[model samples]
Target: MRISTRTSISIRSCHVRRNGPHRSSQNAWKWVASRSSVELAGTGGWLLRNGKGLAYPTPAKSNKSMRSGTLIVLFQPNEERLLSAKAMIDDGLFQKITLPSVCLAQHCVPTKGGTIAVKPGRVLGYLDSLKFRLSEGARRHSCGTFHTGTDASIIPDYADFQLDVRTFSENTQKLAKAAVERIIRKECEVAGFPTTPRMVTVVSSPAIYNDAVATSQFTRVFEWYYGRRASEVVQEMPPDIVADDLVLLALPPGGMPIPYVYWNIGVTDPETWERVSREGELRDLPPTHSAIYAPAIEPTLRIVIEALALAALTFLQLL
Candidate 1:
């Protein structure tokens, strides 16, 4: 099998999205460099400011490879903040490049190393993060009853806390949010508060829905590469309780929904995987986002890079 080397790639800072509008492609490209933040790179070398990164590979045959079309790899940031995708849309991402036929994303998980975890629908739950601050009026009266203050003589004037709710469906999310608000308000009323506590929504994101057809197509590529049954190549993972902002990338605001698939790559160390499995300690393995969590780098990177190339080729019809 032959692969073409001609491809184009560009890297830009996550801050660019929140900065302002991009009048032109050249103007937008200026914001690519970022020194203080971590940057993720693909197989090709760094995507420099001088337009130096390769995008995709195609078959060497000139005529056939030309039919595969150009590939554009976008490395986005701010996913932890749940605003990367929205920021890209607001910054004219589609305007700067041709609208993509499909979008793909992957994340590293604590699953056994060298395996992939994916499913066709409802990969992750919806998220609603809220911040609340009880006013001074309520705190003075409530502190005595709630025992919120350390000093016996002085009553606390205010209290603040954050709440996060996750569910698999929009209806459930709505119900949960309403219930939380009702409980908080009822408590405030019982305390004889003059004013309601301040409430602010920190995040509101929908559940990630994987396109069935797109997921199947990608699964076939994995099966072919691993020379294994589809079930073995693609782990039969149920919908995860975690939530992410990647869904925002697939469903842009005020735009038609695009086909997309998001999957998790196993990143545990091989020796650790076997040891834990043998001792029935897999349940205790450190998961993503934990302070002690760390993945074996070499094979994890190899698997992810291959998965990306295979998926790209499948979508481009170059396979």
Candidate 2:
């Protein structure tokens, strides 16, 4: 993709397929990063293509990189499970590509087709998942699932369920954890349980905290690019409950955390957006994970490519 500037800005793009296990992708990453230090890097696995499943593309192994700085695009393999960032790190991701000065990530949101949203500080929430198993008891209480005698005439004695808690603050997370445990125990006690319920933590991840200064800087760049449509296209939003492990990409093996920004690009089809807006039904739009969720093909991809290119240039100081 080429962006018009005093000196035309050209971005090289490439694709790497994970042939073997997860580590195979890491090896491919090493091959790409072997050339030079990555100045501006963008990593994400959520973006979709016109047909079939998701697409994974990198900005290396093309003709050559930018004259001033190298821009490498990394794809995290398991972002939905919230394990991709840590998994990549465990496979020695940083050893190949030196830690970038700034990392960037973006997701397709349910907003209007031509708009983008940016939040400065803690945008996403912390996630904690727990599994609970209630011991056999004379009485039964409501849970995610219950098991009992073979016949429906008998009362259920055992139950098990999994719960995930998301919070934006440390104090709230602590309080939530305590409250979950207390409620589980109290419910089992009230139902006359024979033994204490077993509660086990399945997984925990920190919130996605965007660097305030970097986010603000990116907002300025976006506003400048949009010009008259700046107010309509660029949205400053509040913290959301959507949680991701992308922040882990900023921390080097043993070094300090680097600055990064993870924003959202709207992908709803323009016609659908307009109809929903006209009917005041925007709140009913399908979100990212909904079964019926599908983003438009044209403007969404256009914005993603343009936004990514602009972000890379901004960090490279070529803008």
Candidate 3:
């Protein structure tokens, strides 16, 4: 019996490994392709690397055996601006890859380290950019040139600028946009402009509402992995930064609404987090768009990788 036992044991081992408690072949997974218009801030590239499994694996090919689901990384051009995700879709992203059972993404925040933030409902608000163009006479005679202290003599014609509006609810967004347009038209009428100040929406981003059930389950798994360090907070996003990718994943044609979780990892160091906590404000922290807004790299990268990995593993669990 010993002569033939080794072959039988090897076969059993392979079968058990493939259908192991940790392995999953039931559902496919997708990671958003990472491309950026601007140079990334501290440790921002970590998301692209870690999400693609480049950081943890020794050799890239080693991931093939363990990988059960399709991992999609969306591609974007360097010159592409807003609506990057939409560009990917229009380019046939869905047609090229297997639709995912779930989508996951993470972002860096200036909050304290070792903490996670999850808002179950309406994590992000709808965003719209309105640009108003004033005619030359409207600018000089009616609106007047914007006074710059250093350059007061500079007079401009055909003034154009963009305004952003964010709304928490979908209906509110529509109402607000319409109301804004009406108010602007009325203002132009009062100002006696030759033509109604032309209003154009340059960018529109839909609101992101996380699935309540899925978010709760994922949060539980996060806490189980990271313990008390993991907790939720309400984080305000900069008006210009919209999670459009998440929006794309949630909507139809691409696929049905899949469970997705977009979480944040704190970039500030322990020392800075403590100081800011004592001060009771984020004033000391650099604003996200500032040139000096560099996050603590090492700890931030570690936490981000851990958070993303935990979510993926939990979703792929066999039992």
Candidate 3: worst 10 consecutive residues by lDDT?
1-10
Q: Could you tell me the lDDT of residue 184 within candidate 1?
A: 95
What is the Å distance of residue 78 in model 2 from its true position?
A: 3.0
Checking candidate 1 for backbone clashes, the offending pairs are 3-58, 4-58, 4-59
Instruction: Identify the runs in model 2 with alpha carbons over 4 angstroms from their true place.
Output: 1-66, 137-158
**Candidate 3 — what's its lDDT?**
0.53
User: Which segments of candidate 3 are over 4 A away from where they belong?
Assistant: 1-53, 56-67, 75-81, 138-157, 228-245, 252-255
Error of 1 at 12 (Å): 16
Worst 10 residues of 2 by lDDT: 2-11
TM-score of each: 0.75, 0.74, 0.71
TM-score of 3: 0.71
Residues 139-214 of candidate 2 have per-residue lDDT tens digits of 3343323543466555556666788998889789989998999998998799677799999887678888888887
